[model samples]
Target: IFFRSAMALQLPSELWDIIADSVQSDSLAHVCRRLWDLLGSSRYVKLNCDSHCVTQRVRPLARNVRALQVKVKGPWDPTGAIDALQHAPFLHTLTLSNMAADVTVGSARAMAAIRTAPSLHTLTLNLGRNALGTDGAGALAALKDAGGLRTLSLDLWGCAVGDSGAAALAQLKDAPALRTLTLELWGNAVGN
Candidate 1:
């Protein structure tokens, strides 16, 4: 009975905003496809969804996405989520939290995309499980030159980012709009 009545009401973006802000992202997204579609539309400022959602349901309507938090699984993970960055032109903050060693072959392209997103303000790459090594560092080094970024957070916990990676990050001292830098290189080979 309640379900029927609730479904009958047309939720404006305003109401969606109220519900979305109050509910947990993962739980809300799992509630049903309708709610996901409602909150995932171009109206939400911050979105938390998986790669598949980004590729299929979110990207096409991502023009308004400002802050996005996504989970990328290792090796078998799809790369379409990275490609979706191009579709979201106005993105300001993007968070790629590591659920596994997610960064592999496609990360360089995504890092490059960060440079391209003119309005991008903050970028968080938590490379906890990946073996970014020097190669990974090089791939992400490209972001140091991006002038529009206000916050750049990289968590390389256990990722083996040696001196080279550290060197790459050091170059950001001159990046234009960078205001906050959150770098966690715990359990790496930086001192070795």
Candidate 2:
């Protein structure tokens, strides 16, 4: 009875706003299908998707997505994820990772998409054990344009980034609002 009544309750849009603001839409959406639909337009949903089916799942929920996490497991084609992000204009946080050697310069294209998202405040990328050399780090320099980005955690461990790549990364100091920055470049060729 409690579950049915809760689902059936039709509160005013104002009341719903109060409820939605205090609670995360991701957890509420998991309670039932009705709640998911109710929160379909809420900008608090945290969505997790893999490279495969990312376009399908993210496109529909793009407007509602506040945080997004994508992991590249198999072949690393960034096209789908890039397309999906274009629709998510309100997305504030993003986490992308590929823990294998296959993640290559294609990730540079992903950075291009990221640079345009002004609403994004936090970004975490773990592209470890790949072959993204100086060029890839140079691509990351585009984050200097992300005016709202406050936190950035980049794990390019063993991605063959030498001194030149480090210099490119140093350009992030120009990001206006960035307050916290973490770079994990261990197992690389960066020198003093």
Candidate 3:
């Protein structure tokens, strides 16, 4: 009904902010372009799109966004995704979740991108059922360099980091501004 009708309309991009779940995979870039075109007049300031759908759509709006949440559906490609985020200059908080088993190098590169995000202070990487391994651990450990970061949440319940991964995370003691850290490894071999 309403969802279908909205999807069919050719309304101005400024009309997107009022529609919930207004993002459609095929039309993301067009909407972003319209938003950019309407810059000051457009009230839509926050965006949540399918991580895969926006991979190609993000570059145009990168400099205008304030927050971003990327949900990986299949195997993660760290380099490609992180490379896209590098264009976002005003990003504050980033949340990456629902990653698949192949998210090794991509996960690391993603963390590295967060470290360089000047305004990023809060990061949440939900790797509950993915396979991050030692490489993932090293990548996450590198985030301590993000000077503005105050909180970090790592959910590695079923990943492959094991005890060595735990050791890697323990090295974060030097992150002076990190006030809270939550690591979820309940189902993983982190204790072994």
TM-score of 2: 0.81
lDDT of 2 by residue, 85-189 (tens): 655777888887767737666666575567666478999888888888988888877877887889998898988878999888888878899999888988878
Rank by TM-score, highest first: 2, 3, 1
- lDDT of every model, 2 decimals: 0.66, 0.73, 0.64
Could you tally the backbone clashes for each prediction?
A: 0, 0, 1
Measured with C-alpha atoms, the lDDT of residue 151 in candidate 3 is 83
lDDT of 1: 0.66
Question: Alpha-carbon error at 76 in model 2, in Å?
Answer: 1.3
Q: Which stretches of candidate 3 lie over 4 Å from their true place?
A: 1-52
Candidate No. with top lDDT:
2
- Per-residue lDDT, model 2, residue 149, is 86
Query: Candidate 3, which ten residues in sequence have the lowest lDDT sum?
Result: 39-48
lDDT of 3 by residue, 4-113 (tens): 45453566555654342244222333445443354322122334455466566555556655566666666545565567666566566677775554667565756566
- Which of 1 and 3 is the better model by lDDT? 1
Estimated TM-score per prediction? 0.69, 0.81, 0.69
Clash pairs, model 2 backbone: none
